[model samples]
Target chain A: MRGKDVRLEDVVMRFGSFTAVQQTNLTINAGEFFSILGPSGCGKTTILRMVSGFIDPSEGRVLIGGEQMNGIGPAKRPTALIFQNLALFPLMSNWENVAFGLEARGVAKAKRRDRAYELMALVGLQGHEEKTPNELSGGQKQRVAIARALAVEPAVLLLDEPLSALDLKLRQYMRAELKEIQRKTGVTFIFITHDQGEALTMSDRIAVMKAGVVEQVDTVDNLYAHPRTPFVATFVGENNVLEGKISHIQDGFAIVETQQGAIRGINQDKATIGDKAMVFVRPERTKLLNGAALDNTFEVDFERRDLEGAFVNLFFKSDTGSIIVHEANLGQHKELEGRAKIGFNASDAIVMRSGELSDE
Target chain B: MNSLIRSYGKGLTGIFVTLTAFWLLLLIILPQAFMLDQSLWSIDKDDQLGMKIDRAYSDLGLLEYDAQQATGDTNPAVQEKIDTLKEEIATLEAQETDPPREYGLQNYTRMSSLHFSIFVKSIFYALAVTVLAFAVCYPVAFTIAKLATPQRAALLMLGLIIPYAINELLRVYAWLMILDYQGVINSLLAWMGVVSFADKTWIPFLEYPGSVFVALIYAYVLFMIFPIYNTVETLDKNQLEAAQDLGGSVFLTHWRVVLPHAKPGIAVGCIMTFMLSVGSYSVPQIMTRGKSGDWFSQLIYRQFFETQNWNVGAAYAFSLVLVCLAFILIMMKVFKVGIRDISK
Candidate 1:
C-alpha cells in the first residue's frame, strides 16, 4: 500500500469545558514514521483519534492525501488504528483476527484465509494461524494487531502507545520491528507515545507536546541539541536547569546571573537584559574542569555517583541547587567526592525565557 | 474435605459439611427423587372396591340383625352365618387399607393427544418467547453496557427493575389489564375509532397467543438482559474501536467480536428465559384467564389439583424439566460454550 500525507490545519479539540488539544497545525509526510511524544493527558491521543476519523475536530479541518475528511467514520476513512492494548479479537483465531478487515470488505472466506496467512507470515506468525490471540505471547499479539490493521491497506496507520504494555526488552525489540514494517509498507505511521525513548528510537521526526500544546517538533537530534522551550529541553531528555535572569544579551548569547554566578549560554529564545530566563545544559556536556577558564563554571560539593552500566551519573551540590553531570565510564573520575570544579561551554548551554518545566 | 478442615478447623468444617448434606438430602435430592418415583408409579384401584366395601357393611349389619333376632336361642347356623359375614368384612377392610402399586411409564404415556399437543405447543411457544426476548433485550443490554453513560445506564437499570418490585403474579395481572378486551390498548383503539367498546366490538387481544407471549417476555426479559449485559460490560471497549478502525461495519463488528465474547451470557440468558417461559403458569393463566388454550404447566396443574391425579402431574412436570434440561444442552452447544462458561 502507498502512504498518504496527513495534515491537521488549525485543529482544536474540546470536551465539554476542557480543551484537549489547542489550535494545532501539523503535516506528516507520506512514508514518514512520525511520533507524537508527550506525558499523559497532553492530547497526543486526541490528535491521533482525529486523524484516524474516530472523531471530528471541533475547529478547522483534517485532511488526508489532500482530501478533506469531514463526517467520515473510522470505517470509511483510509486510516487504521492500533490501540494501546493491541485489542486483538481474543475469541477469533490469529488468522481470523488478521483477516477481519478483509472479511468486512466482502472477500471470500478462502481468499481472506489466504490473505490472513500471508499477512501473518509478514508479521512472522506463519505457524500461528489457527491459535487464538490468548494463546500467543504479548509481542505476538501485538504483531497480530498490526497485521490486522495492515490488512485493510490503509494509507495511514495510527498507533496509540502500542508498546507501552510490553516489557523493556520486548518494547525495544518491537520498536525496531515497527520501524522495519513501516519502511517495508511505506505507510505513513503516526505513533503516539508518552515514552520519549520509544519515540527517539523509532520515529523519523518527533513532536513533543505539553498541556494541550505542541512545544516542539523536530528530528530527534535537533530536539535534544536545540530544544525551543524549557519543557521540551527537560521532557525529551534529562537536563540541569539553572533558574536565573538574563544579565545581558550580546553576540547571539545571553549571560544569566544566578545565585551561584553569572553563566553564559546561547540565546535560543533571544531574551533581553533583566528578563527572567533559565539556562539548560545537558548533563553529559558538563566536564570536571580543574578551575580552568570556561564560558560557564561552578564550584560544587560532590554528593554521590550512580553507575549505570556504560555511564555514571555524578550529582553535586552547588550554591544554588543540586547539579548532575553524566560521565562516560572510561575507568576515570572514580575518586570524586566532597568537592569538585565543573564547567561547560556557552554553545552547549541553552538559554530560554522561563516557562513550565517537566515534572521531576 | 481436607482443605475445608484445614481452613476452618474441624468443628466449623463438620458443621458446614453436615449442613450441606442436610440441604442436599432434604431440599434437593429427596424431593426430586420422590417426584421421580411418584411419576413412575400408579396405584391399581379396583373400580368395584367401593361397591364391595359398601355391600360388605350392609351384609355385616344384616348378619348382626339376624344374630340379634335369634334371641335366647343358641342357633349354630345363625352364629356360623354371623362369623362368616364378619370374616368377609375383615378381608374387605384389609383390601381397602392397601391397594397394590404398579410401577411403569403408563402415567406419561397415558397423556391424551390434546394434552400432548399442548405440551409441544408450550415448548415451541416458550422457544419463540426466548428468541423474541433475546432480540428485544440484546439492544437494550448493549446500550446499557456500552453505549449509555454511567448515569443513563443506571437510570435504565432502575426503569427495568422498578416493575419487578411488585409481585410476579401482580405484574402478569397488570399485563392482563393492559391487553384485556376493554383494556388500555383496546380503549386507545376505541378512541382512534378502530373499534368501540360501546358497540361490543373491542379487540380480543387476550384470545390471541400473542398476549401470552407479550406477558411471558415481560416477565422473563430481565433473565435475558442481565446476563448478556454483564458479559458485554466486561468486553474491552478498545476492541470495538479497533474493529471499526479496521474498516469493519457495525454488523460485522458485533458478529465477529461482541457476539463471540458474549456467548456464555447469551447461552445463560436463553436457558433461563426458555426454562421460565416453558413452565410459566401465571403468565398464561392470568393473561388468558381460560379465554385461550392452556399451557403445559396449566395442564400439569389440572392433573394434580383438578383431577386429583398426582402421579400424572408429576410425570408431566418431570417431562417439562427434561425438556428444559435438553434446551440448556442445545443452547450450550449452539453457543459453543461449556457448563463452566454458562455459569459465568
Candidate 2:
C-alpha cells in the first residue's frame, strides 16, 4: 500500500450525548509528516483513534489512501497506531515482539526471525533480540515499539503522543529519532500530541485542534506567521494577543483603538472596519528599535527579565495588559531593565478576525 | 547475648527478630518436618508402630543368654523393662548375648504400594484441574484485563468475586445440584426428550465419565481466574493495537503477543489452582460422596485419623507436599520465569 493519505470529512464522534469531535475536516497528503496538536481533553487522541479505526466516527467518513474507511475496523485498516504508552509486549523476546506482524501474516519462523533481526538492526537494537520490553531503556523501548509498528509496513503510521511518557531529554531525543525514522521509512506519519514543541519540531504540517474541532491546519510557518483565526494565532506559538475595535479603516489598513493608544495594522486575509477584531504580534517580532520607525511603541518599567542563554524573556505591562517580549543577545547591547521605550515595526503586526479558522 | 554484643539500641531488634523467627519456624515448619520424618518410618509388628527391628529382644519376662560362660537370666531389654528381670539376670553368670538389630528401611519400601498410588492420583487430579480451570478462566480474565472500560470493569470484577464470598462447600454443592440425576440439568434434558425417563431407566447424566472431574474443576475455577486477570490487567493496550497495526490478526496477536504477555498471569494462576486443588478434599468428597471421587487427601486423612497412624499419614502428606513442590519447580522451569517476574 502507498503511504497514508488521510481525509476526514465533517467527522463527528459522540459518546452517549457528549460529542468529542464535531465537524472536523482535514486532508493530510501522502508522506507528509502531519500532526494533530491540542490540550488535554481537547479530543486530539479521539481524532487519532478515529483515523486508526479504534473509534468510529458517529457522523463522518475517514478515507485512507483514497479508500473510504467506514466499516473497516482497526485490525482491517492499513494504518498502524503507536499508543501514547508505547505498549510493547513484556513477555516475548525483543525479536519475537518485533516480528509479531510477520508471524501473524503466516510467515515461517526462520523467515520471520530474519525479518525481525533486520528490523531490530534498523532500529539500532541489533543485539537486543533476546531482551524483553522491560529490559530496554525508555528510548530503546520506544524504538522497539516503532520497529514493531514498521514491521508490517502499513500505509500510514499513527502516533498517539508516544513519547509523552519519557522524560524531557529523552522526549527531545526521540522526537529527532522519530522524525529521522519517518524520513527513512518514507511512511506517512499522523502524529498526535499536545506538546507544541514536538509538533513544531517534527511536523511538516500541523493541525491545531480545540474541543474536538480543527482550529487550523497548515504548514508550521503558515500556521504561525499567518494564522487566520485568533485561536490559531495564539495556539500555534507564543503571541501577544490584543482585543481591539476598528476605530477607522482606510485603503486596506485599519487603525485599531487598543488599550496601548492607537496603532495601525494590516488585516490578514480579510477583515472589515468597525468590526470587533483581535490583533496578535509575536514576542520575538517586537523589535527594540533604535529610534527608527515608531508605528508601535511601549513605554513601561520592566516587571521582570529572564535570561535564557541565547535570548531574554522580558515581561512588562502596557496600559492594556501584561506583554512578554523576547530578545536575542548579540553581546553588543547591554541587557535592558527598569524602564525603556520599545517600538516594533507595523509589518510584523497581524490583525485577524475570529471566524476564518478551521479545526483541522 | 550475641545479638546484644553485636548490636546497639538497634541491636535489640535483632534479638527480637531472632526470637520471633525461632517461634515462627517452630509453629509453621516443625509440623511439616514431623510429617516428613513420620512418612519415612513405619510401625513394626511387635509394637504395632511404623517400622520394626530385625532382632528379637524382649517380650514379657524374656531373656537372652550366651552360654559360653553359662548364664540362665541375662536379658538386656528385661533389664530396661523390669527390676525383677534385672535381678534375675544378675543372679546368672551374665554371659554375652546376641545384639538386637538396629533400625531398618521398611517404610521406604512400602511407599510404592497401592495406598501410595493415592499420592500420584492426587498429583494427577490437581494437574488436570489446574489445566481445565485455566482454559475456562483465560478468556474471562483477558476480557477483564483488556476489553472492558475502566468503570464497567470494577463491576465485572465484583461479579467475579461475589461467588467467592459464598462458602466454598456451598459452591461445590451447587455443582452437585446441577449434576445430580433429578437436578435442574437432568430435568431439563428429560423435558427436552434428549434423555427420557419414560423410555430408559438410566439416563447416565450424573454418572457420566467425567462427572467428578467436572465437579472438582467447577469448585476450584476461581482460583485459576483471579491471578491471571490481575496479571493481564497491566498489559499495555497500545502494544496490542501496535501489534494489530503491524499486520497481526487477532489470532496472531494473541498467539505471538497476548499469550506471551499473559504468561506471568497464566503461570501464577496455574500455580495457585494446582496447589490448592491437589491438596483439597472437600469439593471431591462432598460432590462425589467419597464414591469415585476418592482424592489423595482423603487417603492421607484416613491414614492419620482412621488408622491411628500419624507416621503413615504424615508420610502420605509429605509425599504429596513433595509432589506439589516438584510441580511448582516444573511450572517455574516450563514458564521460564522467576517468581519475581511473574508477580510483577
Candidate 3:
C-alpha cells in the first residue's frame, strides 16, 4: 500500500549491437509522481521497462525499495505497468479485468470481485463493474487500466502514455484524474510521455531524454525556467532562438552578437568571450517595445498572425531566423501588421553555449 | 439475389448466382442425396433365378431338336411345349432386366460385428489423433504467431507447408517408410543392438494402431496449425504483457487470454483434423499395409470394391459423413463459436 523508491544504478540496455539506453543513474523518490518526457525512440520507455522488471539492464543493477532486482520477473516485482494501449483483457468484464491480479495470487472469487469493485470505485468507476473494456469509452478504459494496476497494490506504478489514445479534452481530464489517484494512493508513479504539456501538468519531477541520454531532470517549474541544454529549452516550450557568439560576459550576463545586432542576456552556461552561444527568449516575453528603451530590441517585418483561444501568436522574420511573439487576446492590435519593434529585458533572455535544438 | 446483382451488376452477378447454385445442387446436395438413396435401397435377386433361366434355355434347345426331327408335320404337344418355352423365356428376360427394388435401412443394419468394431475404433482413433495433434500444434501455432520475429515466423510457416506440396498418399507413404518393420526407426533400433534385421526380429510398429495414428496426425497437422495460428496472430501483444505485468502465471495467461481469443480457430482446427483423420483411407491403408486391422474408411472401401456391394459402402460412407457433421456441430457448441466464426 505504500510507495517504494526505484533506483537505476549505472544501467545500460542494448539490443544486439544497438544500445537503447546508455549508462545512466537515476533515483526516483517514494510517493513522487515522476515522468520521463521524450520524443519517440528516445529510450524513455526502456527505463520504464527496466524499473518494471520486464527487462534486465545489460550492464548495471535496478533496485526497488533498496533491494536488487536483477533477475526478478515483472510478476515478482512491486510494479505494475499500464501499456500504451491500456491493454485491458477484452474478454473479461471490467471487474474481472481489475481482479485478474488478485485471482492470480489465489484470492477467492467473491473477495476478488469485491476488491475489484472497490478499486474501480476508487478510480470513479462505481457502476461499470460488469461492462467489458470495449463497451466503455477511451477515458473509461483508461480508468479501468489504472484500477486494475492499483488492485495489485504495487509499490511503483509505471504508465507508458496511457492517455495518448484519448481525445485532447479526455486526455486533459484524465491528467487531473490520474494525479488525484496518485495522490490518494501514494504510489510512486513513473509516467512516460512525449507530450510536454501532460508531463508539465502532472509530474512532480520530469526527466527530459534525447537519443539514449537524460539531458535534464528537475521539477516542472525549474525545467521550464532553467533548461540546462538547448534541446531542453526548445523542446519543453516555444522559444525564440538567436544563434550568435558571446561578445562579452559580465555581471551574471553575456552580450551576444548576431546578424540583427548585439543582444545582452543572462548567461546560464557562463559563456566566455569569443565563444559561440545562442540566446533563447520565451515568445511571451517579447513585447511591443512601443517607446521603452529596453536592453534588447529589434525591428522585424510581419509574417503572419495566428489566433488561439486565449492568446495570439505573432510571427516576425529576420535574415538569420524567424521569431514569434505571444500576445494576450485583449481584442487590441487586431490589425497591426508590417514592420514592428519588439523587445525583452536582458534578464528575460537566456544565453547558453550553442548546441543541438529540438526539431520542433 | 438482389444484393448480388447490386454488388456485381446483372451479368457477372448472374454468373455468380448460377455458379453458386450449381455448386450447391451438383457438388454438395445431389451427391449426398444420391448416396443416401443408394444406402436406402436393396435389390431382390433370388438365388435360383439364374439357374431357372438356364434350365429353361436348355429345354427350349431340346424342343427345337425334336421339332427338326419331326420334319414338316409338327406335333401339337411339341408346338405347345415350344410355345410354353417361349413364354417362359420372355417372362424370365423381363424379370432379369428389372429386378424388384426393396427399400429399407437393411444396408446399414447388416454391418458385421467386426465391421462395427472397426467403425467404432476408427472414430476413437480419429479423436485421439485430433487430441494429440492439438497438443502438438497449439504450442507451435502460438510460438510462430506471437513469439518469433517476422522472418522466423515466416520460415517456420514455410517449413510447415512444405510437406503438403507433395501428394498426400506420398506423405503417408513417407511415414510408412519411417515406421515399417525394417523401416527407419527399426534400423536405428538395430544399430542400438535392440533388434536385428538379420535375425528377422525387428519391432513391428506397423502392426500397431499407433502407426496409423502417427500418419493420420502427420497428414492433418497443418489443418490444426494454420487456423490456430491465424487467430493467435490477431491477438494484441500488449494483452500478453499486461497479463504478465499483472502477475498472471504463464498457464493462467494462456488459459484466460490467448486461449479464449483463439476459440474459433481451435474449433475449426479440431473439426478439420477429426474429419480428415476419420475419413482418411489412404493414410491408414498405406501405414498398416494389411498387417493391421482395417480402418472404417478401409472397411467402406472393401464394401465397395472387394465385397461388390455399393449399397453397404454408401451406408458406411454416409455414416462417416454423419460423424463428421456431428463433430462439426459438437465443436461449434463446445467452443461457443458460431459457424460464421469457424469459416472465417
* Top-scoring candidate (DockQ): 1
Candidate 3 structure quality by residue, lDDT tens digits, B1-344: 79878888999998988999999999999999999999998766666888889999999999988987886657777888999999998888778788777899887888889889999999999999999999999999999999999999999999999999999988888998898878999999999999999998998888888888888888999999999999999999999998998999999999999999999999999999999999988988888878778889998998899977788899999999999999999998899999899889
Among these predictions, the greatest lDDT belongs to 3
Specify the poorest-scoring 10-residue window by lDDT in model 1 chain B.
B67-76
Off by over 4 Å in 1: A290-293, B46-52, B55-92
Residue B138 lDDT, candidate 3, scale 0-100? 99
Order candidates by TM-score, high to low. Answer: 1, 3, 2
DockQ of each: 0.86, 0.50, 0.82
Q: What is the TM-score of each candidate against the true structure?
A: 0.96, 0.85, 0.96
lDDT of 1 by residue, B1-344 (tens): 99989999999999999999999999999998989999999776677888987897888788778777786666678788878877887777777787777899998898899999999999999999999999999999999999999999999999999998999999998898998888999989998999988888998989999999999999998999999999999999999998888888899999999998998999999999999999988889888889889999999999899988888899999999889889988887888899899877
True contacts kept of 1: 0.96
Question: What does the lDDT come to for candidate 3?
Answer: 0.92
What is the per-residue lDDT of model 3 for residues A4-88, given as tens digits with 9 covering 90 to 100? 9999999999999999999899999999999999999999999999988888999999999999999999999999999999889
lDDT per residue for candidate 2 within B1-344, as digits (tens), equals 55555666566777787888988798878877776666766554234221222122242223333323334574443445555545544433232232223233455457655766766676787788888888789988888789989888789889877888898888878877887767778778888877766666434544552665687666667777777887777777776777766767777777777777677778878888888888887766776675564678888788778877676677677767877788778888987878797666
Candidate 2 lDDT by residue in tens digits, A1-360: 358699999898999999899898899999889999888888999988888887889998999988999888887888888877777777778888788778777889999999889988988998889988899998998888888888888889999888888999999988898899888888899999888889999999999888877878889888888876777777777877667788877667677777776766777746777777766888998766576776888676667777789988888777667677798855533556776676666678887764433233
Superposed model 3: Cα runs more than 4 Å off: B1-7, B59-92
lDDT of all predictions? 0.91, 0.77, 0.92
All-Cα superposition RMSD per candidate: 2.2, 6.8, 2.2
